[model samples]
Target: MAPPKPTAAAMADPSPWRSPAQRGRDRALKREAVLKAAARLFNEKGFHATSLDDVARQLNVTKPTLYHYFRSKDDVLFECCRMGLEMIEAAAATVPGSQASGLERLRALMEQYAEAMTMDFGMSISRTPDTALSPENRAELRRLKAQIDRALRGVIQSGIEDGSIAPCDVRTAAFAIAGALNAIAHWYKPDGPLAPAEIARQTADFLIQGLAPRTSERRQPKR
Candidate 1:
């Protein structure tokens, strides 16, 4: 026997099929999940020791599932490294129009950087070696590294000029600050006693104190 005709409401309602844009968004979200899973594994076990299987297992998916998003482990590592660099770049981008003084801006940058380092992607960036990436990727990572260094130095110089920070070698101070902030990735634990915010605050306070003007300098007459 023939089936009954559909009701008006059923005919008017659209199918549950996802649109192209919705599918694209779903793909993007899945890819980001892969990246985060990979980063966490890479952070826990060094990049060389972490495999696609490990990442997929962490995400409760098969290794082939990762292939749907990334070409290989190297691709995932490169992306994570790029993400870490982008985080620093993003924080640096905010310095120019910040209402705070140069030193305050620098402190803010340090806090942002510290927070990033404690994250999965940033920790992966800290532990992964440049040699693990292809030559081209290595070169790009180096370029970004240099850019971050320059940004830090520029902030220090601005602080020096604004009289918010004590006079010191900008290059030396930048290296010192960056090194300290980057080191957090090596020791920070998600379950540790100190929260990310507290760690960031303490790190920024300690680093900024080194650049703070001395009492004598603070009392000096304006030039």
Candidate 2:
């Protein structure tokens, strides 16, 4: 038997579909729709429970249409991971020059990060499950995650070097601080008692002071 014929809409303006700029914008809009639908489905139903068919239904599109934008559920999950990683990097970059300390930069960065994670279009860094993706996708996510961690580590190392932060292993300290900040994205509620900025500020205060060197502890005399 012969294969079915392509519809006029599917075959129409094949050249237009070939235009990079036009194709890019169209792909982006369609992708955005796909991600939004996936995120809602993933959140409403756990990641494993949601399928590509459910996502297609949410967008009122066919399976092939969704596949044109995302090859598989793994592909969509990777997009979410990519987006959350970008937000963390973007938030870290938003720190101001006048922040005055490594700790301050960490704090300022976290403040903005909390808000970015809850933007309603995608998953926050905390809630994103990197393990659900294919090994290749997970590796890509690890690369992006490393980038964000390095940025925060730079600021934390600077603080430690400048005496603004207590002398400590910058890598360990930075990871702890970054982890604390990103965790807010998991449970932070806009309608809850603390707003994003407030949660950020409070988190910063705890981390900054909590991590600072204690000058009051009695020092043991060098043997």
Candidate 3:
């Protein structure tokens, strides 16, 4: 008798993202390339003006093939937005683990957030004209955006607790930071006068001053 079929967990394991590692890698690379091409086309020609055909043409593929990876153009756009927010979340998560003070960590996180926004993929979401994105995609994009906001708030809260950041309404502070960082995605560029690192540093410097410990004393009090 043939060996028993693999269980769902077993099949899912070892990277269900790909069974053939090489094929998986190639697919991922292609997916990224297509997304990049789509972003470029969409940015240059507003989402309403750009279509799957446009993206496929840029990548030398067919619309059906594009659909195989992305259900629709909105799907692609959603992916781009999701990517930006996810990057922020991932980067912010790294800050608390660093040896830097909470304020320093917040700065670093903001800087990293700016750097991430400067990336082509990230910029595409913010700069690209997507007036045509279905309400569903737009809503999803906004929802994922909240995730970024929440992650940033957590960082701010950590700063508050550590006395590295001045006490403030966490929601307001977090939203402000999120808005500022998100805006960077709209205007930042790789060829801009300032490098991503420099911009990030400057942003960090400014925010740190405002956020750094105010009382110069510990919360528990000295014996």
Candidate 4:
């Protein structure tokens, strides 16, 4: 007997099936959507309170569908945290090519950082408890956190050397600036009176004031 004939669906061949590259792209897009939805839920409701079910419902999918992309709720939370950290890292990356004074460069990065905090993924960075993630994830998170810490300190160091910023303890100044920026995530409300850009600009400016060169240090006008 001849082999069974292809069904109409199978006969469609390339039309009915995606190529490997297309399938990969499709999966990535879907995974990103899942992460974004989960991150928003994590920000609105605490990590412990926001279940995978909530995330699935947010995307109008089944809970099992989420498993296709993530190992578990903790995996989703960890990825959200990673996404937040990576965003801040990307903001820092923007500063290296600049010719601006160190203080100016620092302020630019801080503004981006502040704006990131108001976003869903960035808010997850602070809102999700590090202890809730697996030991491995916590380690990875710490590593990423350390990179951000180094970036902050590098700018402060440059500012002091260039005289654009006051001579101060780099560690202490970086800590103060980062602390203030992190607080923005906690109190930020999308519907608040201040827009994210305004908040970013204001918060960055206020912090930079402390780091700016003191009046006595500025070059005096010619007599």
Backbone steric clashes in candidate 2, count: 0
The lDDT per prediction is: 0.89, 0.74, 0.76, 0.90
Give one digit per residue, the lDDT tens place, for model 4 in 1-223.
9999989988774767888999999999999999999988888879999999999999999999999999999889899899999999999999754478888889889999999999988998887779999999999999999999999999889888989898999999888888899889999999999999999999988888778876843657756
Segments in model 4 whose C-alpha atoms lie over 4 Å from true places: 1-14, 96-98, 217-223
> Per-residue lDDT for 1-223 in model 1, tens only?
9999999998897869999999999999999999988888888888999889889889899999889998988889999989998998899987655467889989889999999999988887778878999888889888999999999998888889989999999999999998899899999998999999999999999988788989977789999
lDDT of 2: 0.74
Q: Each prediction's Cα RMSD?
A: 5.0, 9.8, 8.9, 5.8
Give per-residue CA lDDT, model 2, range 1-223, as digits (tens).
Answer: 9999999999776553467887799889889989878876775577889889888888888888887877788888788767767777887777867447876776677667656656543343456577787999889888988898888888878778767778888788877876776666567666798776677677777887766666754355555
Which portions of model 3 show Cα errors greater than 4 Å? 1-21, 128-132, 213-223
Candidate topping TM-score: 4
TM-scores for candidates 1 onward, in order: 0.88, 0.78, 0.77, 0.89
Deviation from native of the Cα of residue 223 in model 2, angstroms: 27
Report the C-alpha displacement of residue 148, candidate 4, in angstroms.
0.7
Model 2 stretches with alpha carbons more than 4 Å out: 1-23, 120-124, 213-223
Ranking by TM-score: 4, 1, 2, 3
Q: Summarize candidate 3's per-residue lDDT along 1-223 as a digit string, tens digits.
A: 9999989998774754545878888888999888888777766676678878888888888888887678887889878767866777788777757466667677878988888877766676677644556888878777877777777787788778877788899998887776676688767766789988888787767767666665646556688
Clashing pairs in 2: none
lDDT at residue 139 of model 4 (Cα atoms): 96
